[model samples]
Target: MDLELKGKVAIVTGASQGIGKAAALRLAAEGARVVIAARGRELLDRVAQEIRAAGGSVAAVPADVSRAEDCARLVAEAVKAFGRLDILVNNAGTSATGAFESVTDELWQADFELKLFAAIRLARLALPHMNRQGGGRIVNITNIGAKQPRAKSMPTTVTRAAGLAFTKALSKEFAPQQILVNSICIGSVRAGQHEAKAAKAGVALEQYYANLAKDIPLGRVGRAEEVANAIAFLASGAASFITGSSINLDGGASAVL
Candidate 1:
């Protein structure tokens, strides 16, 4: 299906790798001018080069989304590069889980900063631009833990829950403006963090991923490209009527949904 994304301008956060990278590539492939942001300058440039090499319009800006200024700068740079912003993919975050008592205030703050505040700041900055254009899309990347909170999943779940609420409320408030908002409730997908964890545990990467897939009803983990395809749809004109909803990308692993 044609997403009708050609000539659109998009900003994707944490876009140096994983789902973010996939989203960037997919959007660029659909003929959107993509501005990719991440804290790692080297990786960010590499992604930009990959996009450019494929003849996709792109710009890379190294940014740490946890900082308010960085979030502001990312949006600004995107607009400056592309002349407008039509889609904002809030995908910059990390998983932080621990026993309730073992979790520190610092850790909580850090998680909120990286996950919650980053999305909040980016949305706040991007909404005005969307409103002026009369419509836009905001696709937030969250995990299934947000809906089915498990024991020992502290700060991450809490913030994701907030993200769901934020998506719903923002969608309602912006529906009139055609600025749709939604989220992807992702389960385990192949990613760098998982690879690192497997290496740290002295387990073969394939075995580690197999263990994760066992719990999923599909008997396999998801792929970053799958998530990105959904994100690209959500950010496209084809998804004009989809708003204030969360799609489960968990391969039937999430029981709450």
Candidate 2:
């Protein structure tokens, strides 16, 4: 059960809440020094403080991943705090729901910049550091919509597809250097967004979740921690040979390859 991650350093984006927060905590639990980056300074600081209270080494760096300078800053800040970077989790993206005709140019640009371009900038910045360390791991938190596109998701579908492509191509490029790059395509998970939507609908949380679960084959949406576990495994030495692959973490919601 030893992830062999002690003394390792990791950078997790969108780490203020949900999956990113869960991943950050999980990595720290496994004995890795963690740097949590996100747009919300307060939330990021809270997560860092919580981890520290749990006897984990952590630092909070608030940065909007959409900006290239911010992405570079995120990497720089993590390295400054941890001395080295061993893992990069690109998890700072939002789900966009809109039809092709309804999607605005601004929305498309925003999605691409936030999800695809952000990953590109961070990965580019982290490459040299990982190469210097002789090896590292990169995990991109894409969505199942990337593979199972729907009419309602225009920009998210397209941009996540690009992220998947980035994951695969970069994985191949970094494998020779012993760095493993992979993507995790998440499906419906119990997140703050869902909770907010449920509250707005004036429905009991359990009823709301049950209604949402009707569409999933597992009869329920996944927990953020569930996805974090998979990410931890992939980032750890346990998945040393895994790269250039997209692992779907949907509860049979996505039937595509």
Candidate 3:
């Protein structure tokens, strides 16, 4: 499983921690030069240094994805550093859980700005560069809530649903140019914010994760690396024929297709 990714370049957003960090390390492990982006400069730089310490090629670019300028700068910096971009993983996002009536217009708009608009802007910027190169890959990290639609998850569910639609639409648009676009819907994963939440709950970390994992048929939440593995496949030549598809990596938490 060479992944045939040697020398290929990838841009991973939200790469400071959580699944984004996992994806960045995995891509670098597979021999792809990686550009890690996030708003936290120190955290992003630390992750980049970890990759380099493992003998992987990586550069850190601190930028907020919600801004159009940052999105363009991210891609531009990747190209400038690596010469070409082969993959884009839109993983930066924010979560808001509230009833439909409780969620304000500002809340919805802010969530969209972080999750949906960022992906849209990055895809738009990457399209011409990918088209010029003849082909590329884009993997959007959405959520299972997009398909399931929980009542308390009004904002996240609505925005993630739109993100799925965006992935599908981009897939069709990029197909002719050989740029494959796909998405991965995440389930519960023990990382970053989740760990912080667990700590705040005053619960034993292992027990908290175990309790959370009990809901899935697989009897556990997914690992960040597991989701990253799927992203790697979608980004690789092995998935050349795959586009406009949504894959779930939720340890059987998502019952829907």
Winner by lDDT? 1
lDDT for model 1 comes to 0.94
lDDT winner between 1 and 3, please give it. 1
What TM-score does model 1 achieve against the real structure? 0.99
Best by TM-score: 1
Instruction: Give Cα-based local distance difference scores for all models.
Output: 0.94, 0.92, 0.91
Candidate 1 residue-wise lDDT, 1-257, digit = tens: 99999999999999999999999999999999999999999999999999999999999999999999999899999898888999999998877889999999999999999998999999999999999998999999999999999999998999999999999999999999999999999999999879888998999999999999999999998999999999999998889999999999999999987
**Model 3 per-residue lDDT tens digits across residues 1-257:** 77888898999999999999999999999999999999999889999999999999998999999999999999999999988988999999756788788989999888999999999999988888888899999999999999999779989998999999999998988799999999999989868877777788998888988998888899987788998899999999899899999998888888898
**Which segments of model 2 are wrong by more than 4 Å?**
200-203
List the candidate 3 regions with Cα displacement exceeding 4 Å.
Answer: none
True-structure lDDT of candidate 3: 0.91
Write model 2 residue lDDT over 17-129, tens digit each, in one string. 99999999999999999999999899899999999999999989989999998988889989998899999999998768786889999999999999999999999999899
> Ten-residue segment with the worst summed lDDT in candidate 2?
93-102
- How far residue 238's Cα lies from its native spot in candidate 3, in Å, is 0.8
